[model samples]
Each structure stands twice: as C-alpha cells, then as structure tokens.
Target: MNILQAKVLKSCLNSEEKVLYLPGNLSQFQMALILAESSKFNSFIFANKYETLARDYVNKNSSSKVKFFLTETSVADFLPIIDKVVVFFGAVTPFIINSFGKIILTCLRTRTPLYEVPHGLFQTGQNLVDNSRLINTDSFYDGVGENLPSLTNVKLSWYGENGFGYPRTVLKDAYPARVIPKFTLVTSNTNWFLYSLSDKRMFYKVLFDYAKRNSDEIFIWCPHPAELLPNTLSHSVIEFRPSNLLLYGLHNDIYFYNIESTDDLIPYCEYGISTVSTCLLDYEMHSKRVNIFNCAGVKNLIAAFNHASAFNSSKEISHNAKIINTGMLKNFDALKFDQLLSQEVSKENFIDYNYLAAYV
Candidate 1:
C-alpha cells in the first residue's frame, strides 16, 4: 500500500473497527501478510486447510492479529461489524465460494466496502468460474505483475510493486525444507486437482524408486496441500491413488518439510524437480536448472486447457525433451484469491474450464 492509501484506510477505520481478510488459496495468502504489514488490524482466514502452507502462515507469523475459520460463512456473525472486507485472492472451493457470496451480499446490504486484489495473473483455470460469482465490489487494486483483463466501470489502483520487494529473501518465521548438502526440490500437487491427468500413483512410485536408486542425491518432497487436505473426491481420485506402502517406504535420502511457501526451499537448492507447478517460476527467476517430468502430459494439459489469452500459463513446461523425467508435477497455482481490493474486472478474460480443473 502507498502512503496515501494507508493513511486513507486508517482514517476511515475507527479504533475499534476490524478488517475481514479472506484468502482464496494458500499461496495467495501472502496477500494477507502484505496487507497486515501495511495496515495493522485484525484478520480472518477462511477455509485454510489444516497443515497446509497458508495454515502455517497463520500459526507462525502474520502482519496483523489473525483468527481462522473452517469456512467463509462462519464469519457471518462478524461481517456486520467488520469495517471493511479484504479478499486477498479469489475463492475456488465450494464452501469458500458460497461464503464469499454471503460476504458480498452482506456488504451490499449493510453498505460495507469490499476490496479485491490480484495476487498473480489468472493462470488458474477457475478464474472464470470463481470471478463470475462476484457480482460487485467497492474498490480494485492492481499489483506489479500482469494486469487482469481491463475493467470498464470501476476505478483501478496500481500497487506499482509487490510488497515482498524483488527476489524475496524470506517470510517471517518461514523456514526452508531440511536437506543434506546436495538435494533437488521435489514438489507436487495431488491428482485430485488435475482430474484429466490422473498420475499421482505413478508419480510417487517413480519418485520413491528414483530415491532408492539414487540414494546419494537428497530429495525434499514438498507435497502441495491439495494432496493432504481432506476432500470428498475419493471416487474420482481413486484412479491415481498412491499405494500406502510407497508413501511410508522411506529412502533416507528423501525428506519433506512443513513450510509456509515452497519458495522458502529455493535458497537451499539450485536445481529442482516437478511436474506442473507455477512455483517453478521462482526457479526461473533465479535462473536455475529445472528438471521437468511428464513433458507430454503437461503439454497435453496445456493444449487442452490453454485459453486464447493466457500468457506464461505453464512457465514450468520445458520445451526441450532432454530435461523431461518420468513423473507428473502438480499445478498448485490453479486456484487463487485476488488481493483485498474491491472493483469490477473485464469478465471476458475468464476461461471457461469444463474438463480438467487445472488443479495441482
């Protein structure tokens, strides 16, 4: 936030008033931290799954005092009294979507203001589905990255730069995955997210087998929260469920970490391994070597889902066939909650995703 905006927001809010924070996904949760840092206030996190990266951010460090809930509607009692509502990212989950709809209605009924901010570009396929549910917002804030397809009626505020500065050093209380001297960053999303590419079982088997075959090189398995969160996609997910024996089978060289963001693992290792993750953009920013897996599957998904206007949609997919490995990476960047700024966006930009969710 700029000096003028912060001052204006602080002045509009009375001493006892509270702010509502609703982050769409774990990675986008960073928007809450940035807002809290700029404006000290109380916050509420909606549907942040247990043990996920976003949940870790709540438990460890935050810019403002925070309390999390199981769903967005859970905050209904608090909404009436809230001075302002800030949706850091867009909502994708069913419960989050429903609750956010309620928040919008309450805001409209009570004359409360809402702000929606963009955490990143609309890389996630749900951009159209999730944003379509949002009928109105009070203000809109644009970030440093690519702008959302232009908004016609609402005023757009430019944040100019992402608050973390460039080349994020570290988040407060955030830690990197533990590793022996030489290890590759093994990150992935569950098959539940990418229904079209049902390869979770095969992905883990290849990872575990590779770990056993190459015990000398360390592997840090940073599984995405989508794989761990409790969900009801059992029937569909069974297609690629990994064997329990493989999950428990330990190769001493392989390890895992419960960190806030996978970016925390970057400083520890140079080269990395993954399937379909936007987090690979972090590696690209560092100019590091990225070992890609399931090149054809990743390409197929891209060709299958790429909307006419998406840019850098799958930055992780290496065009060179030589770097291809034998597994699937997760597309954790599929869901996002824009920053907590309110405004209307050009609805035409949304991709109509009917097939695979593009989930990680």
Candidate 2:
C-alpha cells in the first residue's frame, strides 16, 4: 500500500458508521453513488492503480461528498473501519480477488455485512464456469473453502435459480423509460466473444453488414467501453468512440452515442442488436426489441433466456434478429422506481447478517 493511501484510510477511520467499499469501475461506481445518495452509509471508491479511465469516470460522476481511494490500501487498514463491504464482480479476476477479496475476508472475520452487487444482468449459471476461470484459486488465503471466497457468505442479486448457496434479492427495475429511438446496436468487446466463437472478425462483419443494410433508419451504435473494432470491418460503420460523442446527443448520420453502460442507454433505444450479452437480458426486461446474433450458435443464448417466459413469445424480425419482446414484465412506474431506489436496505431480503459472516 502507498503511504498516501494509508494516510487517507487512517484519516477516514474515525467514523464507527458502516463503510460501503465499492470497486471504481464505471458500472460499480454508478451503483455505489446511487446507493450512497439514497442510503446513509459512507462510501469508499477503490480504483486500481492502472484504471485511469475509471478514476476519471468517478471524478466526473461522483459528488463532492463522495470519497475516493487507491486499491493499494492494506486490508488490515480497512478491517477496523469497514462495517459493510459491497463487491460488484466477485472473484472474477486475480487482481479483484487479491485487492477486493481481502476486504471481504476482513468483513467476514469481523462479522460485518457483505453484499455482492452484480455489475451485469446476465450472470446465469450457464456462464459461471467461464467466469470462474478468471480467478486464481491457488492464491486463496489459508483455510478458505474450495469455492471462491467472495461467493461465500454474501447477499446476491440473482435473477434465476442456478444453485449457488447465497440468498437472493430480486432486483427491482431501476431504469427509467425513455422514448425509444429508431434503432440501436449494442456492441461487446471481442475479448468475451473470443472465448466461445471461432472467428471474432466474422462477428463484426455480420454486425457491420446488418447496420449497413438498415442505414436508412436512424441508427445508433453503442460500443462497449473497451470495444476494439477489427480492421476488416468497415471503419465508416462506427462513426466515433463512445466517449467522443456527446451523451444522448443526436446525429444526422449513423451515431455512436457517448455513454458508459449499455444498460443506461437501453431505455432510449427501440430495436437493439447484440451477441449474447447480459445487457440483452436487461433490454428484454425493459421491453425493448433485441436481436441476438447467432455467431456462436443459439443454444447458449436460448438456455440463457430459459427462465424468461417472454423469450418464447418473441417474434422473429429477421433470420438473425431474434426480436425478443419482454412486454410480460410490469410497466415501468416512475414513482415505484424511485421508491425502490430510496427504500432502506433493511427492508430488502438479504442474507442473515450472522450467516453471512460465518457460513464459509
């Protein structure tokens, strides 16, 4: 830990009130900010040494009252001060398990409340094996169980039953409804597609072709924050990096809206396109029509939507555009959304505070 970081944590340790520890990624940071503004807990936003983008994002989005910290701070330094720990992606990477896992362990030892907040929507059992490979289990602390330390003794926001032992909390729809645009293309990074697809470039080609065929429609392409377009794909298709385009800004030609999470922009889009991404599930929840490109076959994608009854009710838009309609979900009520957001965490169904501490 850096000397300056230690000093920062030491200065903030005066409060006995619970501290909500959150990773500093744009998604997690946004979630933390929402929770902090609505709840009474003080938040500590942790940024990895290399996450310059994340740090900048938090600075821009967070208010003056929000606290920021370097992830290098010692777990021992946090143990005494932190009464509650909230993790976004749990043990998905070695850096995560090492940096954030220590704080979770500390919370466990101290019997502090620990909550596992999901950063993505499609975290079903089908992808657990693929996601778990990112963890370096060999480095786990002594006496830890075979399961990832972060998964044990934590409250989870799960959509379906897949057999993880943690207690589930139904995630109330938080996104507000907006006027649906003509068309939107949601892009994910090749890093994830490369895992299950043969030729990632082919995926982009198909996507570009789809966009070009529908050039007449007012089209908006929202690429993943880390998305890298392949050289083979037409450069003309993607107008600008999402950061360069103004937020919710309009363009006469094909537009690339500058935004962070696709979930944030989904409400404004009418028809959407993407491969098997969690955001598609979110779009379904919002009743937005989405086309799941079958570059990796539809088997996995079909299984993902198995729990969603609305999936079967969707009509096909094209051979590729599996236009799923999620109208089955309750209509978005602005008052209800606000109520859910501001409702006290105590009222929600969470893992027993005692069980969360010692279950592992």
Candidate 3:
C-alpha cells in the first residue's frame, strides 16, 4: 500500500471514537451541527467548498463548535480522520464517491461504523435504489476495490417529519427581524432545462405582463443562485444577486433580492410565483400564496407537490392567475410543529443519532 493508504488503515485501527463529517450545504451543515452538539461524537467537521458560508452560519445562527474544511484536500489527509459521514444528498459525483469510497473501504476492513444522512424531503423515483448512475457500474467499483476498499451504497430516509420539526425557537432567536414584500417572484433556473428559448421568453413575458398590471404593488424578484437574468428581464426590474439581497432596504419599483437560501425570504412574501422548485413547496407548507407554471416536461414532478394551476403557456397568466388555489397542499400545525421540534432540540441526543447508529 502507498503511504497515504497505509496511514488511513493505521488511523482506522487506532481510533475508537468516530467523528461526524458533514457536507457544507446550509441545511445539512445546520442539521449536522445540531447532531454534533447533542451527541457523543468526537468532533463535527464541515467538508465542502462553502467553508466560509458554513462558518458564517454557525457563528450567526448556532452555538455549536465545528471545524470547517475544504473538499479539495488530498483524500489521504481528509478521509483518514473521518469515521462516519453524514450527507444530505446522495453521493452523485465522482469526487464524492471516490472520497467516501475510500472511507467505506477503510471502515469495511476495520468493521467500523459509517453512515449517510440523507435529506429529509421525499421525492418519487429517487429512493428506490441506493446507487447513483455514476457509482453503480461494475468498472468503477472494480478499479477502486483493487486496494481492498469497496464503496457501498448508503441508504436513504424520507424524514419528512424532521422537516416540519426543525427548531423554530432557535431560528427565531438567531434571526429576529422579518422582511415582508407585497408581491414576490420566486424565479428558478429550471428554465435552463424546463423551457426552450421561446418558452423562456414567454415565461418572463408573462411575469412582465403581470408586473405591469400590478404596478402599484411592491414587487421583488428572487432568483435562484444558478440562474442568470436575461438582458430583457434585467433592464425592466431591479435585480439583486444572492450576496446583496439581505441588507434590508426599501425600494419603490419592481426589485430582486440577492440572498442565499430562500427559506427566510419565502415566508415573508405576500404572494409568490415560480416555474417548479422546492421553494414553491416550502411556501405552500408555510401557507404562503404561490403559483407554479407548467413547462413542457416535469408534469409528474409538479404533481408530486400537489400544486394546481400549472400555467400551460405564458398567455395564461392573467389578473386572476394569482387568486387560484389548489387545496391539495399539506399544511402542518405551526404550534405543534414548533413544540415537537423544540422537544427534539432540547434532548441530550437527537433522534437522528439513533438512526445513524443503525447503519453502524
């Protein structure tokens, strides 16, 4: 074995306590932090490109101690110390699979515990199999297994109850102020995949028409981080990039708020619109007024959210478009949800830690 591989093997043999490694996404990072604070784990490590964001979130919103590390480090340097891994999403990329693949091999050899903490949301067709397209092939596994390290498909859980029960008290304590807008357009880059060039033009055209009709209402457009605003739409409305959206200011004309994580933004908007995104479902759960546009494909995905009034075309957007409500939404009791979540947070150990033990 090479020096790095030898080192990993040695570390796996010597270390009795397991450290929890989490992805650097905001939601996952937050959940992992909570787990670390409430568990007997050795240490909580955040691993990903967004180390700065993870630090900012922990410093501002949480009191738990955490270590932030970049994902680009040498695998030998990083994976040796990690005994367990908690990911909100499946290992879908080569880099992710390779890194975790090494850890899996080490853990398997040592008979140590390792686990994947999947996102709490439920999506059809994703949970039927544990292996992703990139990692499931025999050639990929065969090459990696030569070193006696094998990658096993981590299991997934539809922890939807955990979604409703996120500690609202902690969130309220962290972010005290509320910023609400009269009308908000929740834009997504789904147009990149869901709409053709003409369809995209029509999509925005419908929004522009609606904005023109409701000139008196204060409108704010919130774009997804991956979305690029077309010049046509850019010239008409005030656009805010994700970095500058949360400074708290008032504007007269139609504007965009540049903010990361629309979780906070969606709740405050009186009315909302999006072409197909989880944010729309979030808005629905929170009882916010929102609409989904019907693109050419993704009808089944749209139906999964139980949203009604999929605008077949841009021309269908009229004044009455905002008034339509599909009662198919699943709403949680706000007080009960908060109470259950607070109870979970107050525990010495989170329920997720027990779930993690099951894999070990």
Candidate 4:
C-alpha cells in the first residue's frame, strides 16, 4: 500500500522473465518457494491468497527469497509485469482444470512463457501447459511420479528438485543427504490394507521376504500417516512399540518404528519399496535401489510416451534400479476405475487461491 512498496511490487510483476505463482495448496506454495530460491530472476507470488502460509514457511524454513504482492483488485489487471505463469498440479481433474485454468488460459492467450509444475512423482502423460491455440511451453518436472498425463501441447521439461518434506525458500544444513550403508526403507500405502494386493503390496510381508534374502540389511517399517488410525481394521497389528524399534532384529531382519514424520529416516535409507506413495519418488532420488511393488506408475508413463527420449533428463528412475513397468492393466477393472476417477474429478477438492487477509 505504501508508495515505495507499490512501485517495487509493480516492477516485480512487470519485469521480464519474472514468474507469478498461484499455488492452490500448501504443497504448491512450498514448491514455488523451492523454485524461487533456484531461479536467477526474482519470483513474485500473490500475497492475498496465502500470506499467512507464505510468512509461516519463511519463518520456519525459508529465507527471504520471494516477493509477496497484494492487488487492490484482481491482479489480472497487471499482466504486463508477468513474464511467465506457473501452477502446480498433481492430477488433471476437472476440478483442477476449472480452478487453475483462468490464469493459465490468460497467459496462453498472450503467448506468455506459461509453464506448469506437475508436482506428482511420476507426472505421467502429456505433462501440463495444455493450450489449444498455440504450442505451450514445456511442463516442468521435479521427479518421477504416477499422475494423470497432461493434454497435448504440454511437453515434459526438467527443472529438477532438491528435496521435499522440508521447508521451501532455503535449504537447511542439518538434514544432510547421505544413505545408510545397509538399511532398507519400507513405506506403507493404502494398497497394503486391500486383500487383493496384500500378498504382494504388504509392507511388513515384503520387508520380511526381503529381509530373509538380505540378513545384513535392516528393514525399517515407516507407516503412512493414515495407517495408524485406531478405527482401521488393522489396528490390532499395531504392537504399540513404545520404544519404537526392534522387531526381532536377531539377524537384522526387521525394525518397526512408529514415528510421526519420516523426514529424518528417509534420507538414510539405502533401498526403498512402495506402491503409489509420493515418498517413493524421494526414495528413488536418494536411495541406491528402489523396489516398487506395483508397476502402474511405470506402465502409465510408457503408455504416455512415444519412445525412451523422455527419460533422458530423468535424474531418478534409471536402469540401475529394479524398475519394471509393464503397461498392461492386469487386475484392473476398467469400469470401476472410470467410475472412481469420474467421482474424484466430480467431487472437487480443488483448493482455490483467493485473497485472504489471514496473514499472521
């Protein structure tokens, strides 16, 4: 509102090559901070939508790297200051296309450098930046993930991710990236509870089987956040390890820990296994060998691509790992899948980034 601040804010949006971010959720906001930290040009973000979240992320984890601006009216008026438009999308649901399409379509109309950051691990399909009128800018990817492929005109581009599960804007020196010599990280996912995939996708079962083969390694069972809920049928399985360690590690077979966050243990894990969890991407990035239980993510990516050229800039997902993606929907029911997907897109959980004076 001050004269000096207004000038700077206007300059940020008007300046060439400056990216204005519209993050729909905390994940998107955090990702924007990471990108801003790396960008040679300054990054501008809407202050009205997430000033509180912005300030909180900066106070806790990020340094002062991003500029926040508030528009008296819709910031859409100051389009000239924006060099590029970027949004983070995981799945291309109808809800998402509606919520974010406004700014994206606007930028495309002007032939601006419109880029989309598909934050999901695989980010399969066409990528993002789906423009009908013109060839949109390439979609930026952080890591490999299983997500809905973007529409045509959206190309995959590499921006590379430093790390997730941490604060944005600034990198902390405390959590150094180093792998444990003989530790295997096992992740819990929703599929584990399903009887169909239980035999193959079960975390404890796979760990036990894998442990039997490699006695030298310690398998750590880091359950997903929702797994421990007492209401679930698997509550009895929770042995209540107060000490949070030692699951008959006689030959270092298995070690179970009930921790709130796996941010610390994740990096130390040399090997990892998961089915559809986002952490699998992190494991693939940091771990030596990552064993994914299901090949759905891999299969989808292959189906989306014409050939192997898309994998050229991929930092994770290499041939060294045990990545086998068969594009067949073996046990998948097409009708059931379509119904579920339709329901999900129709439900509309898309968080809108609108102006709010709730900054702390």
TM-scores, one per candidate:
0.50, 0.56, 0.57, 0.47
Pairs that collide, model 4: 13-81, 14-81, 121-144, 121-145, 122-144, 122-145, 122-146, 125-149, 127-150
lDDT of 3: 0.46
C-alpha RMSD of candidate 2: 9.8
Best by lDDT: 2
For candidate 3, write residues 1-360 as lDDT tens digits.
Answer: 111223335343544444656553565665666555544555556455566766565567554555555554443466556655544444334544554544444444543444444343322223222222343322312111111111223332322443333322234334344554555645554423334556655666666666666567555565553343354333333342232122222342332454445566665666666676545545555555566667654466556544455665445554344433333333333444323322312232232233322333
Candidate 1 regions exceeding 4 Å error are: 1-19, 24-26, 39-78, 81-84, 88-92, 97-104, 108-113, 118-122, 125-181, 190-209, 229-261, 285-287, 294-297, 300-360
Relative to the true structure, how large is the alpha-carbon lDDT of every model? 0.43, 0.47, 0.46, 0.44
- Residue-level lDDT tens digits of model 4 in 60-146: 654566776555235576566676555565334454555555555554445454445555444344232221233212321122233
**Candidate 4 segments whose C-alpha is farther than 4 A from its true place:** 1-14, 24-27, 46-51, 59-63, 69-80, 90-92, 95-101, 108-111, 126-156, 159-185, 188-265, 268-271, 276-281, 284-291, 294-360
Best by TM-score: 3
- The better candidate by lDDT, 1 or 2, is 2
Give lDDT tens digits, candidate 2, residues 1-360. 111233335453365455565654655565565554444555555555435654665557644445556555644565577666666755445555555655655555555655665555433222343324343343311111234334433435433332221111123354454444555655454445223334345555555555456556554555554443354222433552233222233533343345445566666676666655556555665566666645333345445563322121123224344445422223223333233323344422344333433322
